[model samples]
Target: MPIDRLADLADAATAPRLVVKVGSSLLVGPGGTVRGEWLDSLVRELAQARARGQEVIVVSSGAIALGAARLGLAKGGRGSLADAQAAAAVGQIALASLWAERLAAHDIPAAQLLVTLEDLEDRRRYLNAAATLARLLKAGAIPVINENDSVATAEIRFGDNDRLAARVAQAASAHAIVLLSDVDGLYDRDPKDPAAQRLARVEGVTDEVHAMATGASSSGMGSGGMTSKLQAAEIAERAGIALAIVNGTHTAPLARGLSGEGIGTLFLPRRRDGARKAWLGGRQRMHGVLVVDPGCAAALGRGGSLLATGITAVEGDFGRGDPVAVRDGDGRTLAQGLAEYTAAEIERIKGRRSEEIEALLGYAPRAAVIHRDQLVLL
Candidate 1:
């Protein structure tokens, strides 16, 4: 069936978990100063959301802008990567301090989190980060998360934050994601067009929807434009998480938008898999390929582990923990999994039974080439 239309966010009031992403435009003003009044009002609404039994997680972008201002750096464009990192190191303290102070006014405790792409790319680290966020929420503290720009390069960028927020929503098990944007909602044409109109609802972020988004953010203070927000909606939708792209300039926008009033474009969730499995399947980077015989391919199809005996060949110099693609003897991609052993190690055990693995390597890391838990068939 064709994706017809999305339901309004009217039910957002009852969602148990809400992840709100505020861009630098909403957090910083001219001269790189923090928007204290705006932040305070937003936090008040967040506090009220908590009182109404909602767990609000904020993904904010402003460290670089605020940092550049503090360091007396040039405006309008970013400096070298190292210079940006240095600015981030200094600016993060100020950002955290501001959020802490503002949330404190409502007697709400806030936890500061700094993360990079690697944190979500690696499975073990992903689990650890997810657990910490879950724990913080359980303790009734709102997590104020931002990219660790001090060390990240292209990964923690402005255009990336929108997608990062979507991943955070999935990892944290958020029921909804709200992207507070410079614009109220998506439009069918260039927003500058006199006839251009905002789209109030989006069913699925198909290729057609993406083509509607054009132009980069012209705001020197921000990078997340309509294109990035649409990309974010695609990610959030597949994770079965509702997302809203609403203007952030208004006071208490979070509260008003969540109550399902007509404010911005709301992209409803489309659950694909259990959150962890979906992350593993869609987010991880593959380093190599493991070619197996038909017997092994059939086993995987039957939901069995990938055994050394079934593997016909191992290609690449990947480490034990690196992700790899699994292929059948016919050279068709079968699945993807984290290698239990290095590519060199797998070379030695190819076509050997699980029992022979210990003798071949002198150390057996279980029997499966890739444990069932770590494998996801394509």
Candidate 2:
């Protein structure tokens, strides 16, 4: 896509549902204080979008930075996982309060939504989260989302808000995702070097651009780098959500970028899947593994349902109605399905006939371990 064409798309996006992600570096100033002026400007733009009748959700990163400032841990280059977690706990409160005050100034109410990987990974949780956000939007409130860093472990972490933003875009059925970062946009090489040129628009992320992206925050306040931003863009693109990476430091960049000013790298949206299917595809995180026999694996590969007799072993502690990965005995994942039986139930009845399920479990809600309609072959 050309820069001009992307400018046109951005203008069209003004009234569409949007998910905007702001990095920690952009939200905080030197000495770790909230950049009041920057946030005020950003909020003003968001208010404008809302005035245009666009529903917007913000995925913001700055809790840890604010927490560090509040705790007087201002000059550190790095910290332990414990330190980061503690900072998040303290800062999240401050972050929400700050946003509330800012939004109030514009007569817009802001709501806080703290989510972990499990919220998106679990189907029930995912639906609940989506419902809450949808209601907030319907009630004319902007939701400010952040990772629930207080209790997140390495295994169940979003790693960065960029990925979280993409997931939110998918959850909200957003039409676009605008990522405001330090750099103006993606470049063929390091933007710091004079010779490196800006990539004003990308129809799709190519191998060369993927290779060019490297490193985390030079400011030492956030974990996300250009690489993670690119990955987030890919996720949004796959879901047919338009994306923009603009310089957050610029004055009113969000509004300017959306007005066809051509100030960022614009990623064109791909052809989309059905809304329900796209939500299901992006929301479920692999919960447990069900090792199936070779015959079952082949059947599933051919888009067949998983029967009770096909499962050899169940791993992990997932409940009935949770998403589980179906793998062969060698441990390669063949498909993902909504398990009809709990892990405990599957363990007891593995390799049994479908007719035997009622007798063995006292009740059988489903004859197959996973019905074909709920299972997606990998």
Candidate 3:
């Protein structure tokens, strides 16, 4: 793809979804101040993209930096884990408020989601988070996601938001991710060296590529450097999401980069399995079983969702969002999917109409026992 065609990667007709990652250096200024003017420019670009029919999700980093500043911690200092956590606890609120205020200026509602690595590791929690993001996008609100730094221990945290942004792209089923950074893009050698050259595009994040990455961040506010950005590219590639690294220190950086102004490095996706189907197909365990009738089996074969009306029996103690096997009356597994309701809930609604679900479950009913989008055939 030519540098001039970069914008097409985010075209609504072609991609439809995008994830933009704003690092701490871009969002927060010296002494914990929010970079209001810069943020307003970025927010306008986001709003324009949204108006063009793109569903955008933002993964922002600034909580720890803001928190540390509030606590009067020295800049660039590696404080104790407790200090970092306490700082994150206080800074998260300020960070969220900044985003909310800026985005609101464009009449774009912002919803904040704080997550730790564990949230993505757990199947149920992952599904729930993904579902919430999907619903938020559908409702025309942009979700502003950040790591749950306040509670995340060193061992349980992402430490940086680059890789976290890639995971968010996967969860949100985004087509491409734009990483707004201090540097323009990847370079052949030290960017400071006169002989160094910038690479316009990266084919893949191979060993040689990893070797070129520098581990330390020049800006103390952000933990991510080129190394973490490369790791994030690798994650996005495997998930079939394109990743772009570009300089965002200037006004309208996103608009310039996406406009194909020859400003960054674009990493193409090697696959197209960036949805829940891939994860569902690769799961090693099925927590429960749903025995459906012949009619339901036929319906599933035609790509229809599993409805309570077709369920003859439910087995195991699977909770909502747990992966389960869909079986027939003779006990042959027909497919596998995440349950919309728990085993007990399905048991109570088996062979019942969709309309009768509210009466049985004592709540507003879901349309399917297992939605087709969440199901995968064996």
Candidate 4:
């Protein structure tokens, strides 16, 4: 597909609410130096978008890279976990300041948010983060978001900002996402090969698409590669959000891409409604699973809530309001929803009538194990 066929970015038809991710290679130079001129150009474009009534959020990655430079660590070197944490601690402030300084030049307010994986996984925290971003956009402020690497461990961290940007798109209910990367876009083969061809548009990310992913970024300053971008593309597809990968090696990449230069790969969204349902369905991990009987499954299929009487068993320890998979006796995942009761509470009350719940745990109970409004059938 030709890039010119797409609507202009300044036109809301293209993307009313957009999230642009700038990688370390594009924002930070050797010796941890900030790329001021490059950022200035990007900011100019973003400011223009805002003036035209388009809301924009920037998910940036460069704190660790800059911190490594400040600590005198070699480029692309992430020492021990502790060392990386320390570097983040130092670099985050610098990264935030750099963004603020650049954005201020355009009379744009910059807001910084450091998020951990748990922030988006926990239901309450996720809502809070979403609300915060929405409010910032409402106030005409551009948020500069990043993963909270200083306190996040390997187990609870989004190792790269690509996936984090996708999560941000979900949180903000963004129309589109743009990843300003070192490479222009996904290629049919290794980008280094002269015969390689860049794909202009992708409807979905499949196994063959995954196979086309090359390797970790060669820049050494960033952790994400083609694989990470594809993972992000999958998330965006499920969430009904279009995503594009454009080269950020030069200034005004966003403008250049929107100018119909055929410079990037654009992944069209699969669906646009039910953003919340898409989010629940796209979750890669669930805290627990609830296995219901056939009768319960039938009731759920009929748009009914999951009553305790229908649940036969529960697996995994999870707190109230945590996401859980709903399965039937056949072990087929029927849906995913927020649980009303703790795993232990559910275990004690399984198979009991909803009205009899007062006696089972000595307290009045809610109507269902999972409410129809909260559930997303898979």
Candidate 5:
């Protein structure tokens, strides 16, 4: 498609749900103080979008900035992870308060939602968070989300809000994601070089674009660089959401980008599956593996539920409710499912009948190894 047609589709996307991510550089000044005026303006624009009957969610990054300023930490200091976590603990509260106050001016209520990677990893928690955000949007409330840095361990950290924003966009079934950062848009080369030029549009994250992405800037406040931004774009694009990377320095750049004013680099959306299928496609990790016989593989290929009789082996330690990969005898993953039995139980009852399960294990909760509803054919 032509760039103009793509821009027109993005403009039409304004009527649907949108996720806007603002980086730390946009929300803080050089002195590490919160830019209340800039935040207020951003909130006003978001409110305007809401007034147009669009649902807007903001994934903001400035907790550490606010916290460092409050704690009088010197910039570029080599602080321990514990110290940084402390700063986040302090800043997150202040950051939420600042946003709440700014949003109040527009007569819009903003709710703060802090989440860790674990929240998205756990199936129940993931669905709960999605439902809560949906309800808040339906009630005309702006949901402001941030990483729960205060208590998030290294293993569970989201690292940057860019990726988190893409996850939020997928969870909300957003039509578009606007990522506002210090740089205006992606460049063919380092924008610092005189010969470098901006790429106004991208259909996908091609190999050429991947080669052009450099590391993080020397700026101490922000964690994510252009490379992380591209990774986030890839996530949103795969889920079939248009993504825009614009300069946060430009006031109301998000609104302008959505209006097809050509202020940022736009990523065209791909054909999408429904939201649940998209979520399944992007699952980050699987818990265990279920190796099946040829018959079971053929059954799954024909959209059939896995049965215990066809099970040849089970590998890895996993709980009954955890998600696991279903593989064929040669060790190729054929599907993913929520296992009805634990790995140990599967070992004891492999190739057993429902009647035999009770004789061997005292009881049988289910006949199928994994019911059809719990299985996703790959």
Candidate 6:
């Protein structure tokens, strides 16, 4: 799987989707102000990518850094996690508005999405996120994504935007993920070492690659380092996505990476089009169970939608967009789909016709309890 840089450029230029991850160092200056000019250039890069028929999704980090100085936690050793979390809460507003403003200049609508690991960890939430992100892409809007650090504890948080970006790329079915970082690419040893060497490309992230891993960075506000980027690269590789770690200091950073200019290390996936199916077939854990009649089970097996009429009983107090299991009367799992209605809502609509939905609940979000596209038959 040795990557052909020029080949990658050609392939990526025609790719339907791309996810670019912007580290905090690229977004904020040492003075703690948003790097407007840098962001403007990045926006222009995205605009050009869009013109080439590529849908661009951005995962930006800098919220906590943006808030640190403002909260008087600026002049210090890396502050506590709680302090960083507080900063993230306040900085998210600034970060979102800044992206919106920058992209607006090019008539590119930027939609902000703040997510935690839980959003992608839970099967239902992952489906819900995938659907919403897909909708935004279909509507010709660029998603400005960021990690939700405000409530994420160390045990539950992704910690770095790199891994989070990988998950976003997988969920969005992106063709490539460009990690815009301070460094140019992977090195044989610490770049500071006199004998260090930079590898232009890597085919796989093996044990040897892990041995080359470094610790947290010294230059930026981000907590992640080259080791984390490699970790993220592996995730992208497993999902059949190409990952590039390029220096964000340069103008048109993403463009250079995708154009096959050999600006960074590119990690190629082992296979194309099958990683997603294999991952999905791994039996994702679903939260709730919905017992349906035989007819409903047959319909599901045929790739039809789950309707309220087919539902006979519900178990578990789940909310809208939660993944629920579809089972038969004997309790055998039939399929799994994200719920359009909450447990209570489903309870009231069970065994009711689509026509009776509006009258019973005064309104219906959708006719089907679970859309056909979201349901996965077991």
Clashing pairs in 6: none
Report lDDT per candidate.
Answer: 0.79, 0.80, 0.83, 0.85, 0.78, 0.80
Best model per lDDT: 4
User: Which parts of model 6 have CA positions greater than 4 angstroms off?
Assistant: 1-3, 6-13, 75-78, 256-260, 272-378
Cα lDDT tens digits, model 6, 1-378, are 333562353243545688889988888888688778888888998888788788889999888888886786854214687788888888898899999988999999999999987787766788889999999999999999998888888766788888889889888978788888888788998878989888887887887998887976766578789988888876677667788888898777766655645677878766543533323422234668999999999988887999999999999999998778899999887777778999998999999998888998897559589987667655
Pairs of residues clashing in candidate 5: none
Model 4 regions lying over 4 Å from their true place: 1-7, 74-77, 282-284, 288-316, 319-321, 324-378
**TM-score (all chains, Cα) for each model:** 0.76, 0.76, 0.72, 0.80, 0.76, 0.71
Tens digit of per-residue lDDT, candidate 1, span 1-378: 222222233234446788889888889888898888888889888887788677889998888888888998876226677777877888889999888988888888989988887887777787888899999999989899998888886743434578789878888988778888877788888888989888888877776788889757756577667888877776677667778888788887765555535567778655565665667665635789999988889999999999988888888899987889999878887788788899999999989987878888898557687998888765
Regions more than 4 Å wrong, model 2: 1-15, 74-78, 193-195, 204-209, 283-378
Q: Candidate 6: global Cα-lDDT?
A: 0.80
Task: Tell me the tens digit of each residue's lDDT in model 2 across 341-368.
Answer: 8899999889988788889889854858
- Flag regions of model 5 displaced more than 4 Å: 1-14, 74-78, 285-378
lDDT measured at residue 284 in model 5 versus the true structure, 0 to 100: 49
lDDT value for model 3: 0.83
Q: Every model's Cα RMSD, please? A: 5.3, 4.7, 10.6, 4.3, 5.0, 10.2
Better of 5 and 6 by TM-score: 5
Best by TM-score: 4
Error of 2 at 316 (Å): 8.2
Off by over 4 Å in 3: 1-5, 76-78, 273-378
* Candidate 3: Cα lDDT at 249: 90
lDDT of 4 by residue, 1-378 (tens): 212223444466557898999999999988788888998899898988888878999999998888888888663438778778888898999999998988898888999999998888766788899999999999889999999988999778878899899988998988888899998899999999999999988888878998999768979878899999998887787777888888898888888776656578888865553767766665656899999999989989998998899899999999998899999998888889999999999999999987789988898898788988888776
